[model samples]
Target: MPKDQKFQKINFDLINNLIIIPIEINGEELTFVLDSGVSKPILFNLSDRDSLQINNVSEVTIRGLGDGEPMKALSSKGNVFKLGKVKNYNQDLYVVLDKEINFSTSLGIPVHGILGYDLFRDFKVEINYAARNIKLHNPDLYKHDPHSKSQTLRLSIERRKAYVEGTVLMENDEDIPVKLLVDTGSSDALWLFREPEKGLEIPEKNYEDYLGRGLSGDIFGKRTKVSGIKIGDFELKDAKAAFPYRESFGFIKNLGDRNGSVGGEILKRFNIIFDYARGQVTFKKNGNFRAPFQYNMAGIELQHNGLRYIAESIAGFNGVVKSEEGSFGNVQILLENKTRLSLVPEIIVSGIRAGSPAAEAGLQAGDVILAVNGKRIHRYKLQEVLKMLNEKEGKRVRVLIERYNKDLLFSFVLKKVF
Candidate 1:
């Protein structure tokens, strides 16, 4: 075998708070989400599985965050995986057979599967979040620059998962030491498990809400802002955090001893270096390090759809539009001969939080959002649209939506209910 490359530069896409990398699986190019929380490489959401060659396949079962039952998957081996200039032979992977979960629409791009610990095990990966690029260095030849201001923290590995010790200041001025899993896959800033025995409880002000969508179903939890979090020599104040209901997180509760997790919302503030081989990680603050952390106050979830439109007559106007929610709608709209239609990407409302500013404005799932604050929806990505909604509390949001082939206008002010 030839010697591996000493260094490899890999460009990546930062979508929906996840690092997406392009990789080759069995000589076929595919997009995979880089997640440090996953122990092994998993292949799922393939458009055509028969085209990919595989060997030694067996059936398996896997469980994730939701209320649904465990999903049926496949365990396969002897597949070549390539990341940038580096390659690994005869790797193992888990393939999910289910096709119900489509991350592309939610992320505004194609995502084939997830790659995790397996990639970090052999290389010292430096992730420059600001530049949207990744550098994989051969561990044997990798060296940390002596003049850099990056802080390094030892990582405790268990079952291929990385964890670090941190201190969280409670509202009562009590500082509690906790073990936090470094999970790049999760978008929340922090997730503190409620442990009454450890004096851990839900913060004074919090809202019962849906944390995120998991493989099984919606993961419900409480969202709050914490006093502060200290990791090594760095400290962040008033960080947004989540506390999942213990009963709702049955699977995560069984995953060893852990107080909480450090997710992408917090990690994005720093340029990170993961040296899994050396059992340590480094952090360097970026431009967004001091940005205030905010949650969605609009109470609506938005998804992306390819550019497509139709014409419908305005003669028969009804308050309701017969179209499927969460799926693409093909409604015919009638336009005059001289009328010009603007072709832009479709942004659909996927979910609505009860009593939210959006919900109060009569926004419902399946509403095709056309604009926000007079700005066209096509001008922004799904995440950017969300940021506009969460920019500030009490900010007025003017929106336009298409329903039943009629353009409707609405406005609301973002407010903090919790």
Candidate 2:
């Protein structure tokens, strides 16, 4: 907790490429995403608000990517946000009043809100993806290692989002200089905005699909692969990218001049150090640095459910075995010592794209996935399962599900539609 210490270590939860951190707000401990793309800390999806003491509350309207209308939120000032022993007073936060969307379910953990640019502005942050830890250093006393092999890139801060210059390989094999936002909050590898001025257009072989879920609603976009993306001396080939329709951007259209965003999918390949105070970001490649980017071809969206167990009556059927009655039950378990229990992750079908493999196979929303390709769902993390579904075209996938207490088997083959 000492301010003069070289760096303060903070443990984090890495779920589906998103960084979730624990912090205290108004003396209450809550989980928040460490997002560099957001300008200020924002709180949302809290069912109970009267319990927290938030000062200077005012109604506000905010717009974000997606098709839904502008969200109605509450703005508050003078709130104490405590990260470890470090406390920031009089901080500003935008609290969403509407509770229709809950990120906790999708993230597989409770996410009270997002902590953004303000945190990086106050300290130098070093994120080790392999170690799942973050080190916070005082800018005045922090010093970069002279013998480190990490590459440092100059950053352009616009509206609190970090942007860097990179080269994108077009269909013609020409490298186009592009300014990309370093967005750790986004799951995709890269997102190129279609701007006429920049001569940016959708790739010839691209499919229209759901990009992601935004604060407002579903974001529809084009999914495609670029020949490569060059960041400094490192070049990543066949990177999966998204191009959200212009209308889906809403108010963000007027924010800045940038070609696209570089998201966690690409950033995860490196151990990143964000030195906002110095206007520089450093990166060192990890073991997954060369892994090829892939998209979900199964066409089913999944959400994680915390530790759960199959009911005693349904214990005999372990997903692989066929059930005579086709009925199964699941029970949520409460553990006094959660650490003693090895967590077995549960996932449910949240959405299915029309005409896609999963949809054609009769997969529907609310189906509890018990297994994928004969492997138990608990054996893999949410991201792993997603990658499996998106693996290779013509690959057969057999999914077992528990729907309304009835067990059902679904099978499909991954295909490239674009």
Compute each candidate's TM-score over C-alphas: 0.88, 0.86
Candidate 1 per-residue lDDT, tens place, 53-100, comes to 767999988877676778888899989988766888889998876886
Which 10 residues in a row give candidate 2 its minimum summed lDDT?
322-331
Model 2 earns a TM-score of 0.86
Candidate 2 Cα errors over 4 Å, as ranges: 48-50, 146-148, 253-256, 304-310, 313-347, 374-394, 402-406, 415-418
Q: Cα RMSD to native, each candidate?
A: 5.9, 6.0
Question: In candidate 1, residue 406 scores what lDDT?
Answer: 85
- Angstrom error of the Cα, residue 363, model 1: value is 1.3
Worst 10 residues of 1 by lDDT: 324-333
Candidate models: Cα lDDT each:
0.80, 0.80
Candidate 2, 1-418: lDDT as tens digits: 3666777789997777888999999888888988878887888767534577788999999866678899888899999998887788889999877776667767655678888899888888899987989998877778888336679999877777789899998777878899998988887789999865665778889877888777787788888888889998888988788898877777675746688899888998989888887789888888879876766788888886545654323323333432231101222333333212223556899888888899999999989898888887665666677777877999999999999889899999998865
Under the 3 Å rule for N, CA and C atoms, how many clashes does model 1 have?
Answer: 7
